[model samples]
Each structure stands twice: as structure tokens, then as C-alpha cells.
Target: MWRDPGAPADSFYEVRPECTDVPKSRFRIKAGKTLSARKWHAAFSPEGYLDIGKTLSRIHRGGIHPSIRGEVWEFLLGCYDPKSTFEEREEIRQQRRLKYAALKEECRHLFPLVGSGKFITAPVITEDGIPILDPLVLLETNTDNGVVVPPQDNNAGSTMAPSSTGANLEKVTDKRTIQWMLTLHQIGLDVNRTDRTLVFYEKKENLSKLWDILAVYARIDTDVGYGQGGSLTE
Candidate 1:
């Protein structure tokens, strides 16, 4: 992580240099006011029905505490319905995890960097959906990872991965998959630049996590694919 002398660490919670000129008493010194973990838990019923209105009031009042921020964001993002019961939300999470894993499994062979602790900002496929294997061209400014296009038959250039039959990898002829491949380099680019101001992105694994996220999104929403500056979806 990079040093920010004005603050302890460069992170979402850390105040940037530009924000340092504000009144500390109204901002920096008011950290204790954020919603605490205990209060956050109390907003949920035993059966897991969330007090959406009350929770929103508290959140908008002081923001959420970092300890439970991830869980809170899940609700905010509509990952689970506010009216859903505990058992229902648990089942939703399990199904979502399985679907995501399946999506990643489908994409892993299309590009080597899918789950690899590295990403590439270079073009790995052409407009016509052809694989590009030039190492020099695939290398990014501060990253390293090779592209892996699934194997295809000598006669037919199909991109099917035998998801149902469980056979060897095959070339992808599907337009959706090809579109997903085209967005890989862009995902790497935005991912690398996502939190560059903060030191958290210095770790390749962290960048890879972002890469996997965007890649999975691209795979899921092939119609929209991926776009530049899309990593700000917090």
C-alpha cells in the first residue's frame, strides 16, 4: 500500500489529501458515530426479516461500520430481499455461489487469467473472435499472465467446453463467449486502475480478485459485456 501521511492508510475509509483540509471535528473526529456491529445485528429479526426502513435510517444517519460493511452491502445491492427470511437468504447465497463457480469454470479455459493471481491489459482476442497468443503483446505494464484459448477441432473452430458431457476443452464459437473474451483486457485495465491511489491494489492477488469479479460479470451479462471505468460499481 502507498503512504498517505495525512491518514493512517490508503483505503475507502482513509481520508485523501484533498479531503484533509475539511474540519476534522465534523469528519475525522466523528468516526465513533458510524453504525456499530451490535446495532446492525439488532435491526434484524430472529427469523431474518430486516428492518429495512430502520436500517436505512441508521445507515443514512451515520453510515455502516467497517466490520459488517460487506454484509450490509449485500443487502444494499439486492443480493437478498429485505423481506426474505434467514433460511431463504441462506439458500440464495448458496445458489449464487454455485452459479458463480459454474460461470468461472466456464470462463477459466477461455482465458488463463480468470482465477490466476495475475491479469493482462493487452488484447487477447480479435474482433472476429480469434485468439491472440503473442506474449509480447499480451504483457501489461505491471502484470504477467499467459492467455489460454481452449482447443478446437482441426476442421471446426467451435468454442464449446463440453459443460454437459465433461470432455476436453473446445474452441468457443459462441458470440457471447467471444464477446466475454474481448472484454478480458479491459477488465484487467480497469481492475489494475481500480484502487491504484490506494495500496491495496499493489497485490496481484487483489487485482486478480477484481479481475475475476468483472470477468464473471461479463460472462453473466454478455449483452452488456464490460466497459471501461466500470469498476466503480460499489
Candidate 2:
């Protein structure tokens, strides 16, 4: 998960003074009670900011239970603003979803091969319902003939000529879009090779989700590019 758009970058690591205001006795999770939604609401200030020191102290004292760990970690990781009310947080979440969707759409447009599926075997279709063969397929078919097929357009019952040669294929010159595609390719390769032993990463859907998240982050923060690493560390 990404950091909250509203929070300072350093807020994630720095301890806030108010987080320690609670009495030590209240710091730990109550016996047998996990950090439930109700308790989390109680820990926030009326103005919306979470009492980070207090909340962290409580978590440190008792530790989060497994059942609520996913939800609780969202707050810990800055996915949600500690100061936000439930409704406000929900709105933020929705906005982030829309932003991510837009980024994914841009990625698909820039890289025709990119898709949100276990396997992108379907042919790419033009606006007028003509099916454009995947570039990989075209390349394989033309390997012996030495011809490169261009993206075909069949708008309103009209056909466009195929590109002359593979060597003359149109190249993406926009540095940003090219960098994004490169980052996307690297992420897929890394994800596939990094966690071969992990059952969770074995799932195609999980891999796709990881790719989508990294892609969205790359687009959101252009300064950060993909790095080579093992799957777990990545």
C-alpha cells in the first residue's frame, strides 16, 4: 500500500509527541481483546488526527491480533490518514482507486501487450471492431518471411495497409512512456523469478496485483524507477 496523500513523508517513521500521552496501563491491548474497529475509533482525536504515540504504544504493549492485522496495518502503514473520520477515509480510498484505475488505463494504452489478466492471449481490437494480432504473434509469423505487420485499423469498413518491414516498426520515443513500459516489463520478470517457492506469489492474480501496484506507484512518482531484486524484497 502507498502512503496517504495527506501525510508528510517522514510521518511514517517519526514518533509523534501525542502518541505517548496515554497512561502506560492503557498502552497494551486489553486481555483477549484485539485492536478492533471500535477501539481504533476511540483512539482518534475528535479533530480527526490519530494519537499515534498512544495507538502505537497500545499496539506495542499487546500486539495486533491476526484477525484484524490487515485492517490495522493499513493505519500503521499510512494507507489511511489517522486523523480522518471513517467517512472521510472511505472517500479518500475511493479517490485513490480511481487514480490507480486511470494509471492502469494509461499503461494499457502505452503498452498494448500489458493487461490485467492471468494471460493476455486475446487479440487487441481496434475501435471499429477489427482484431489486431498481438505483436508477438505477428513477429513469430513473419520471422521466416521477414515482414513486420503493422497495427491494422478497420474503421467503418475500411482497411489500412500493414507496415512495410519489421525494421521499420514504429518506436516509442516518449521517454516517460518508454520508461514506464520498461518498468512494467522488469516488474513482471522480477515477480515471476523472485518468489517461486512462495505459494501466494504462485497465484497469477496475486502477481497481477503486484504489477498493478508497482505500475501505479511508478506513474505517481516518476523519480522512482524499478530496481532489480528478489520477489520478496521487491
Candidate 3:
């Protein structure tokens, strides 16, 4: 696996940066508390302006400053909701994993990436004065892993693993486990939210793909039938 600084590391918290001299009245720290239009503009000289594409080009070529990478990601995701504080953002984050198992199974193609510690997003700051960023940090972490932990809600004492019939690597269709599958699926979608809706794919199209994957898995691995609206409900 590629060594990346962004891989999972020891869990600890650090204090975020303080607001500079930007006018507190007009420019407020928003969700993620890492970015604001006023704050961003302030990062440059008062006379300078930023073009998003050009700025990204610079960062991509020159690399993002280590201190500001989190802010840059937040800005790119438009995750800085003005109404949500860091604590609120965290609560929302916790609620995102109510359906993890289903999501992992839904996007099962990416499973190998997770098990290989390839999806990690933390930097492994080097001992050298100049540090490099790496994304492979753990065998189990990914972009969604930060906000969503494994499902904790107990439902009827059933374990999460698919049944033997459904365990086939090529397919998963255990009917008795539809409830568990659907629950995990919902959690997956919730944790992947962005301020820009459907940023990566068309909303309807993505949902359709999810439906096809889950429906097929269910039919082949379980006795479950796809009742009307069942796919959407998932």
C-alpha cells in the first residue's frame, strides 16, 4: 500500500486556528470553523483576489500548506455551514453511521481499498524538515470513516456478517438480513453528504445504481423480494 500522511493515526484532538483580523461582524467562522469567504480573502493580501481554478492549480502544483489542508478540504466540500458549529458538525457526524454495513456492501468494489489501508486521509508528517503527505494509514479507515463509525444500534441481537449462503464474494443475497442491510445502506448515504448535492454523480443515476446493486445482491443471496419503494427506502 502507498504510504500517505493522511492515514489513520492515534486519536487525539487539537485546537483549531484563531480568526485573524477579518471583521468579525461580517465574516463569521462557519461549520468546520475553518473557512469563510471573508477569512479566505484575508489569507491573501488585501489587494489580491482568488480565482478558484487558478488557486487549485497552484495548490495542486505547489501542494497545500500543511496547516491549511483541512480548511482547504472544507472549502472544497462547501461544508462550512454558517449555522452549524464544530460541536454540531460533530453530532451530525456521529449520526451519519447508522447504516455503515449496507453502504460498504453497496460499494463493495471499494472494499479492497479499505482492507488494504489505502483509503486513509491523514498525513504521515516526516522526520525530515520537509514533510510529505500519504493517504494509506490504516487497514480500516477511509474518507467516510472519519465521520461515521461502525453501526452501534442494536437490532434484534442479530450480528452483521452475511449468512453463509450470502457470503459468496461474488454476491450477497441473504433474505433474512434485509433489515440489517437496509439499515447499513442508509447510514452510508447519510455520511457521504456534501454541501453541493450530487457533486460526483447525478442524484437519480447514483440512486439507480445503488438500487441495482442492492437488489441483485438480495435476490441472489437472500430470499427477499424487492417490494415497491423498497429500494428507495433503503
TM-score winner? 1
Per-residue lDDT over 137-178 for candidate 2, one digit per residue giving the tens place of the 0 to 100 score: 454223232333333342222211234454333434345654
Residue 154 shift from truth in candidate 1, angstroms: 6.4
Runs off by more than 4 Å, candidate 2:
1-51, 118-168, 230-234
Query: What is the per-residue lDDT of model 1 for residues 1-234, given as tens digits with 9 covering 90 to 100?
Result: 953223211244444444445333222212434566888789889999999888888777677766688999999989889899999999988998898888887767555567667677887667776656465443431223222444545335534221222234344566766777778788777887774544555677888888888888888886777888888773
Please provide TM-scores, in order, for all candidate models, with all chains considered together: 0.73, 0.57, 0.23
lDDT of each: 0.66, 0.53, 0.36
For every candidate structure, what is the RMSD over all alpha carbons to the true structure, in angstroms?
A: 7.6, 13.7, 20.2
The regions of model 1 sitting more than 4 angstroms off are 1-33, 138-147, 150-173
- Candidate 2 lDDT (Cα, 0 to 1): 0.53
Residue 65 lDDT, candidate 3, scale 0-100: 41
Question: Which 10 consecutive positions of candidate 2 have the poorest summed lDDT?
Answer: 4-13
- Give the better candidate number (1 or 2) by TM-score: 1
